[model samples]
Target: MREKLQHVAGRVWLYPHDPDPEAIGACVGVIADDRGSVLIDAGNSPAHAREVQQAIAAEGLPAPRWLVYTHHHWDHTWGAAAWPDVEVVAHSSAVDLLTAEAERPWSHQYLRDQVALDPKLGPSFRARALAVPDFGELAIVLPHRTFDDALTLPTGVELRHVGGSHAPDSIVALDPGSSVLLVGDCYYPPPFHLRTDDDGPDLAMARRLLAEKHAVSVDAHSAPRSGS
Candidate 1:
């Protein structure tokens, strides 16, 4: 799949999700500001993350000074090590989940074993993890800062925790200037790997926010849309 960044708003750019490849990573957002840009989520792997960095440079935007996680899902947080210089941020609930994942050993054999033993670790996930040449290099860097409810950055972006069935730590980043909301999978249905019948929650919070103040809503795994 071609890796490219799509401008969604005046100051918001999105690396959209491509479904051509199975187990592909989610969409990532870049909020550009004179103060210093902010990243929505790390890519699924180091290689994937590097693509984002390359795209940013190609567009002549400043490298992100901060990295924010929408949730603690592997696809969203695994590439964290790629941006070591940035101060990472996430919902307070994500720390423990990320810590647990970080404690686990990452290796081809371990991933295969998990897939065999745990229904949640399906084949697609294994394939995605294996895409990286060296599992030993995979790392999940925990957030350097966290918030329970909402926080605003100096760049004028707002981070808000709006937990839903998709994830208890689900959050969104709102760039008021652009009227764009970067909603991490907070509105997506549960993954098939989870093997749960529950589809998930509605995007009421996201809808309300957009309806109240924004013009565009960017989903982690879908193209940016207008009118909520």
Candidate 2:
């Protein structure tokens, strides 16, 4: 239901902010270059994915020919099925995780597990999941394509493996063509939302280390465009 796109820098735009208020998903990124548009991360769910797909169409940009998964987090990876046509790209490690997760069907017990993960936020998350008409519905599509530590796409987007930030398979995409580096969830996520546990993605505290490391790496990666 929300229709908004943020042109952050150059042709770099953000369908920023998670449509689901309680979802851990972060803002989605889009890079519209001479080659074509590239989506940084998918939204939180099938519906969320469709919403962003429509939002991209509303922007008058060409459908994203490519999708780069910054990491394997659910909020970013689950919606990938929405764009079965795009050339999906992700880190090799992420490929393993995504493939493995697809075999596991989501159930109401998943909510109970979340509650067990964080006593503070668990009940609320469980309630939200229950509220969704089809919360138990689960599906995931592995990337038709993949990469190792780094890759360069035709759109002039540079994806370098910058894990040890959020997820071990995390990557920071540098788009000299767009003058924006799509770091995915590598940037600081909301502090309170950091729930690093045996079951969660990356530990929230680990993000600080990721930020520190990615800051140096991205700056080096963007020096020419930034004139630094």
Each prediction's whole-model lDDT (CA) = 0.82, 0.65
TM-score computed on alpha carbons, candidate 2: 0.74
Off by over 4 Å in 2: 19-21, 113-132, 135-137, 187-228
Alpha carbon lDDT of residue 148, candidate 1? 97
lDDT for residue 120 in candidate 2, whole number 0-100: 73
Report the Cα lDDT for residue 35, model 1.
72
**TM-score for each model:** 0.92, 0.74
CA shift at 18, candidate 2, in angstroms?
A: 3.1
lDDT by residue for model 1 (7-43), tens: 9888899888766556667878999876788999998
- For residue 72, model 1's alpha carbon misses the true position, in angstroms, by 0.6
Instruction: Itemize residue pairs with steric clashes in candidate 2.
Output: 17-27
Tens-place lDDT per residue, model 2, 1-228, is 455776666777777564354555456778886567888887667676787788878889778889888888777766777675788888888878887877764666776676687777563455346333475444676777778867888878888886764467878787674456666656433223454443443455435434443222221111212222
Candidate 2 whole-model C-alpha lDDT, 0 to 1 = 0.65
Model 2 misses residue 32 by how many Å? 1.2
TM-score of candidate 1 against the unseen true structure: 0.92
